[model samples]
Target: MPVCFNPLDLLMKNITPRSQIKRGENHSTRDVLLRLFLLLGIFFLLFPLRTVVAAESSGSDQQLIRMSEILRNKEKALQEKELLLREKEKRLAVLQQELQQKEKDIELLRQRAEKVLAEFQALKDEDLSRLVAVFSAMKPVAAAPLLEKLDLPYAVEVILRMQPRKAAKLLSAVNAERAAAISRSITSAKAAVE
Candidate 1:
C-alpha cells in the first residue's frame, strides 16, 4: 500500500514544528536529504541571477568611471588649448603694436627724407640761378661758347632761364646745329607739358 502525504501538512511541518530537534541526533535521513536538496536548489536557482546582476552593476560602474575620466581629460585639454589661444592672442596684440610702431617710424623717416630732398632741390635751383646770372653778365659771344660746351640738356635749361632778348642774342652766337637742336628740345618739352 502507498503512503499518502498531504501538501498542507508538509508545508505546515516545514513552517513550524512542535518538537525541538537537537542537532544530528533524531533527524531522519529522508528529512535531512530533502532539506539539503532544497537548499542546493535555492542556491542554484538564485546564485547565477545574483551574479548576473552584480556583473552588470560592476560593468556599469566601470563604464561610468571611464566616461567621467574621459570628460575630465577633455576638459583639461580644452583648458590647455584655451590658455594657448590666449597666449597667442596676447602675442599677436604685441606684434601688432610693434608693427604699428615700425610703421610710424617709417613714416617719420620718409618725411625727413622728403624734407632733405626738398632742401637739396632748393639749393640746386639757387645754384642754377646763379649760373644763369653769371652767363647773362658775360658777352653773348663768350657765353655762347661756354654754353655750347655744356651738355645739351644743361645748355637748353640755361637758355630757357634767360630773358627772351638775351636768349636770342646768345642763340645767334651759338653754332647753327647746336642752336637748332636746342630749339627742337624746347619745342618738344613744351609739347609734352601740353
Candidate 2:
C-alpha cells in the first residue's frame, strides 16, 4: 500500500532551530499550537449536544401536531351531534303541530255530529207530537190496536209522549201481554236515562 501522509502529524512535528538562541521561540510556538488544538476539540465535542437539543425540540413539535389533530376531530364530532339534535328537534316540532291540527279536526267533527244529532232529535219529537195528536183524535179502542201492531220500543215511546189519561186508556185497551212488554221497555228506558 502507498504510505499516506497525515496533515495533523505534520503540523505537530518540531521545527528545526536555526541556532541555540532560537530554542525558546520554538517552544512558545509549540505551546500556542497545542492550545489551538484543545479549543478545536472542545468545539467539536459541543456540536453533538446542540444536535441532541434540536432533535428533542423536533419531537415536541410532532407531539403538539398530533394533539392538535385530536382536538380538531373531537370538535368535528361535537358539531355533527349538535346538527343531529337540531334535526330531531325540528321533526318533533312538526309532529307536535300535526297532532294539534288532528285534535282540532276531531273536535270540529264531534261538534258537527252533535248538531246533526240534535236536529234529528227535534224532527223525531215533532213527528211523535203529530202522531200523538192523531191518536188522541181517534177513539182509544181503535188506536190501541194500531199501536200494538208497532214494534214494542216505538209503541212505548208513542204511549209515553201521550197525555197520562190517554196513555192509561190506550194501555187498558191493548192486549195484556203487549201492554206488559211496552211497560217493561218504558221502565228500562227511564232507568237508563236516570
Candidate 3:
C-alpha cells in the first residue's frame, strides 16, 4: 500500500540503475541513435551464417532420401525374381508326376497282354487236332474264318495233313471263285512237295 518515488528535487542521491533510468530526464537523441545502430550491425552479421547452415542441411537430406528409394526398388526386384523361380519349380513337379503316371499305365498294358497270350497257350495239342478234324469232316463254309485266323503256313499244313478228299470238299463249300483258287494252290503245293 506504500508507494514512494524520488524525483530531481529528492535528496541529492546519485545511485542509479541503467534499467531504472527516468527516460525523460536521462535519455537523449544521440543515445537512442547509437543503440539503434548497434542493433542493426549485430543482425546483419548473423543473417548470412544462418542462411548457409539451412542450405547445407536441406541438400544432405535430399541425398539421403534418394539413396533410400534406390534400396527399396532393389528389394522389390529380388522378390519378383524369387516368385518366378518358385513358379518354375512348381510346373516342373507337375510334369514329373505326369511322366510317372504314363509309365504306370504302360506297365499295366503290358501285363494285360501277357495274361491274354497265356490263355491261348494253354489249349491242348490233341484238342486242337480234333477241332481241325471236325472242321474238315463237316466241310462247312463257316470253318474258313477260323482257319484264316491261324498263321497261313500252319493252316495249309493242317489242311494237307487231313484226307485229301475231305480237305477238297471243305474248299468247295467256299465262294466258287475263291474256292477254285485255293484248290489249285493246294493241289500244286502237294504235287511239288511229293
Where does candidate 2 stray beyond 4 Å?
1-47, 191-194
Top TM-score hit: 1
Q: Tens digit of lDDT per residue, candidate 2, span 145-186?
A: 899888787788889988999999999999999999998899
- Candidate with the larger TM-score of 2 and 3: 2
Taking the tens digit of each residue's C-alpha lDDT, what string does model 3 give over 60-147? 8778888888898998998999999899999999989999999999899889888877766555445557867777766467776666
Top candidate on lDDT is: 1
RMSD after Cα superposition, model 3: 14.3
Q: Tens digit of lDDT per residue, candidate 1, span 71-169?
A: 999999999999999999999999999999999999999999999999998997897798889889999999988988988887888889999999999
Q: Which whole-number lDDT from 0 to 100 does residue 170 have in model 1?
A: 93
Alpha-carbon deviation at 146 in model 2, angstroms: 3.5
TM-scores, each model vs. reference: 0.73, 0.69, 0.45
CA error at residue 23 for candidate 2, angstroms: 18
Steric overlap count per candidate: 0, 0, 0
lDDT value, residue 94 of candidate 1: 100
Superposition TM-score, candidate 2 onto the true structure: 0.69
Give the least accurate 10-residue stretch of model 3, judged by summed lDDT.
6-15
Candidate 3: the clashing residue pairs are none
Instruction: Let me know the TM-score candidate 1 reaches against the reference structure.
Output: 0.73
Among all windows of ten consecutive residues in candidate 1, which has the lowest summed lDDT?
9-18
